[model samples]
Target chain A: MKNTILIMGHKSPDTDSICAAIAYAELKKTLGFDAKPVRLGKLNRETKYILGYFKIEEPELVTKIIEPQSEDMKQDIILVDHNEKTQTIDEADNANIIEVIDHHRIVFNTANPLYYRAEPVGSTSTIVAKIYKENGITPTKEMAGLMLSAILSDTVIFKSPTCTEEDINIAKELEKIAEVSIETYGKDMIIAGASIEGEDLADVVKTDIKLFEFGTKRLLVSQVTTAGVNKLLETKNQIIEVLEKIMKEENVDGVVLMLTDIVLEGSELLSVGKYASLIGVGFNAKVGADSVFLPGVLSRKKQIIPKLTEILI
Target chain B: MKNTILIMGHKSPDTDSICAAIAYAELKKTLGFDAKPVRLGKLNRETKYILGYFKIEEPELVTKIIEPQSEDMKQDIILVDHNEKTQTIDEADNANIIEVIDHHRIVFNTANPLYYRAEPVGSTSTIVAKIYKENGITPTKEMAGLMLSAILSDTVIFKSPTCTEEDINIAKELEKIAEVSIETYGKDMIIAGASIEGEDLADVVKTDIKLFEFGTKRLLVSQVTTAGVNKLLETKNQIIEVLEKIMKEENVDGVVLMLTDIVLEGSELLSVGKYASLIGVGFNAKVGADSVFLPGVLSRKKQIIPKLTEILI
Candidate 1:
């Protein structure tokens, strides 16, 4: 019998991370592999809405990729959406990553040769959909819907600079299969995902947090999309306190939270911790107290991370 | 105008490394990219014989992937065959690695998402050949011959344990295109590659060297194929001296030389420096002075690196 393989995404599960893991796991299962989809953390509002709308269940929550006591079993895992150690599940270093299907910058290595397929696309779902097509397996309607929602969520309805032509084309094919109007369903999903009202400031700040190492320094970058950035900024001091607390707790050198306004196609950037001033230097903007508004900064992967890496490193 | 993209393999250019780069560059050029294949070092006798057989010129030798004075140029590179920092050319850290097509264990990272396609196969030429087929482009006779020889050379005419069904199938297709009998051509290539009659001890030992870092300790592993291990063993002391000199000059923790006998399907292992005994410990074999012969050990990637990593790390 083949060993059971777990398919997982990065922590603080976003729509792309959660949905791509499920979709790829489904594809793997169809191909006769004993694969199961898993999530590293609780699904955010966006992912929950997407799964609910498509009548799909959330993946099994796994705190760690490998159980410490089960070392003899040698758990095999396939990573999706993200491939960075800082963003992956706990004890991922111990897991035997047999394959990776990602649409993110790679900071991964392996002791043995394995299957790795990464592309500079908007979403991991786009790549998964292409894989399904390559394998001559059409995704079920529910699966197609989940993957389409993930693409729309990650690409911000094709507004993100990270969105590629392949993503748009794959989304169109998926939309046809799911029998949904792309514009209507995409807008509804985006608007549903953008609602963060009545949520705790700490939860909002930590929802999509990712840690990045620049030279010897570590920086934590968090992002949350909202229709109303100005409304969220009303509690700026509380957010700063939460960010600072997270920095100290995580022992990171700096913390940055991007309160992105999807409609405005920009972000209200907030900074805290030791290297906060470097953000201003990186983006060539003024950091007033703790916040700055940057126009046309939609993607953390394409826009923010590259700029931060350049200045910080 | 499109920017010139350099397609390169790892240093100490082997048959698979050299041929895969040329084949991939040819594929990219056909797809309308300005790509050029380059080598990091002089070709080995096996590689030289393969290129001569195919009537293909050697790739331009490049000392560095990116020149220090041309930092603004941002040289775009597509790595083939290997993807480790220690094995890559100098200044590769500065080059914009846009794509990678390799068949080795990955220890690569990039700040931006790029096209990375890796598989666990015997040779990179097998993957490149598949790409050619995927694009609906049949390789020319010379290209087919080159790729076929590469697969034969790396797989030791399908004798290495690393050889896969895909490699065999791809070689069959390439053999027909190249109009060469697989068994005849493959044996000829392997036999031609095995002759190290009058080569210097230093040249023989350093011909196919690879550097690996295990937790802070760096180890240099080199391999040379021959049909006659006894012939090479006559000068074992001189080879040990050369390995010792390499350890000191390169500041490595250890140096290992595997005199692989393709016909016998085994390697006569030699070691020097601080972690030399660990090699014997890794293989569960007794070390006598500086040599140990392990039966049925062929692929370094499959047999050697993993064992070394397990014990060393």
Candidate 2:
């Protein structure tokens, strides 16, 4: 276990993060490296369902980056999905980070050379799939299903603006390999995760929060996909309470919790922080006591974050 | 042409740099982007012979990074082989750098997002070749030969420490695609580049010099693989003059010219600038006149730079 290369993504691991970590570890293992996939957070319902469907065991949960000893310092790290120190484990800064496969803006630089594959696509799994093809490793049908499901989750079934032609092309190839229909499977996978019934309001808000940094300013934006925004709005006050606590604990300039409705193709934003009103400024809409309507804004990466950065930064 | 993406590698480009750019541009073009390969430097004997052997046209040379107009700012730039500001063209800092595929330490950071694919391997062409496979595009016979030659040249025919199993494996696969014997082709390609007859002394020294930085200290290390060290050592005085001139002009802390003998598997070091005696400190060798012999040292990336960096920095 100690000798095995631990492959993982960022905290609050989403479908794309977990699938990519596993897929990449499978690739490294195919190349004769002793590798295993781990997750920073517990699997959500959507990921749990997908893994169960494929009959693959859930990855081990790693809440902390283990403190490195002298011999352990030589251990290799391969980070996927996110690259920020805030998003990754604390001990990540000390380990020998050999490679980073992510889909976010790079805020990390190292003095020594390392392998980094960062593509501005919908999902990290898409890039990992490409890597599998590159090394001439045809993924198993089960692996193909997981990768295809991940692409659908991250891109919101091609409804989100982050969906590129490359993503669609790769997903189409994966669909044929996995023997899944795009319209039926993509919609089914996305809707499975959107069910927030058996969860706490705080847990729902905290599931996919990503910390974004621009210059000296820092912000945390939490997003959750649901079938209906109105279902989440019932507990809007409780969601704001958790978001504010997280903002204070994380010491971010602002906090935004977006309840994105997959069917409506929009989001309801709730927030409280130092510059929370700047969101209203950027979107050209007035914020109510708790939330604001964001029409046709589904992706945190493509729509929300860039729009906020353009205004706030 | 205006919409065509200008793909290029670093200044003083090598076989890997030129071939990777051409190959990556081919991959992107196959994916339906208007991409064209460009070179930052004139071809040396090695690259010229390889391209001529494959019957491929030389890429258009770009001495400077051209400034883009208002609307042209959207023109995407994809850099290969290097990402350092010192190594890249001046206009690159201002251009819309969309993707960077390199094999060196990354010092480049951007405000906005971009695609970056970096691997710690022998040649950038290996990464480009993998991209070819990922996109399901079979490389042309000419392209395969170019990529295969680059791996051999950069890895010094797998004798250098930078040659990984992945590089060797890729080269073997490329050998089949190129219809060439690895043993014969690799040796012949290397020997073809070692001819320095009638070449200017400065041009020989300047051809493969790479700038390295540790903290604030900047140094240039120029290396050339030859059949025998005696040829370069005979003109040591004339070489020192050029090294000194380059040190002053480039504003670097120091300079070392390595004449690496392919057959003997060692390098003859010529030094001029601050901390000149530290080479002797690191290698425990006597420096007489302008040169010192490093026995059993075959690579600048592995053998020379890291050893000197440990002592000097």
lDDT of each: 0.87, 0.83
lDDT of 1 by residue, A1-313 (tens): 4478999888877899999989998899999889999998888888888888889888888997546456556788998988889888788877788899998888987878998999999999998998898677999999999999999888888889989999999999999999898888887787788787777778878877889898998999998888888877887888888999999999999898998887788998888877788777667666455678889998887788888888887
Q: B7-95, model 2: which lDDT tens digit per residue?
A: 98888888998988888888888888899999988898889989988899999987765666674565577899998887887667556
- Clash list (residue pairs), candidate 1: none
The two-chain DockQ for each candidate, comma-separated, is: 0.69, 0.61
Top model by TM-score, which number? 2
For candidate 2 chain A, the 10 contiguous residues with the lowest summed lDDT are A281-290
Candidate 2 residues lying further than 4 Å off, grouped into runs, are A52-55, A67-73, A111-113, A136-138, A172-192, A210-220, A234-256, A270-295, A305-313, B111-113, B173-192, B210-220, B237-255, B272-292, B309-313
Q: CA lDDT of B26 in candidate 1?
A: 92
lDDT of 1 by residue, B1-313 (tens): 4468999998878899999999999999999999999999989888898899889999999988545356566788989999899889898877888999998889988877999999999999999998888678999999999999999888988889989999999999999999999988877787788787777778777777889898998999998888888887897878888999999999899998889997777999888877787777776666455688889998787798888889889
Candidate 2 clashes between residue pairs 3 or more apart in a chain or in different chains: none
| Cα distance off (Å), candidate 2, residue A56 | 3.8
Candidate 1, residue B122: the lDDT equals 91
- Model 2, position A87: C-alpha lDDT score: 82
The alpha-carbon deviation from the true structure for residue A52 of candidate 2, after best TM-score superposition, in angstroms, is: 4.4
TM-score attained by model 2: 0.85
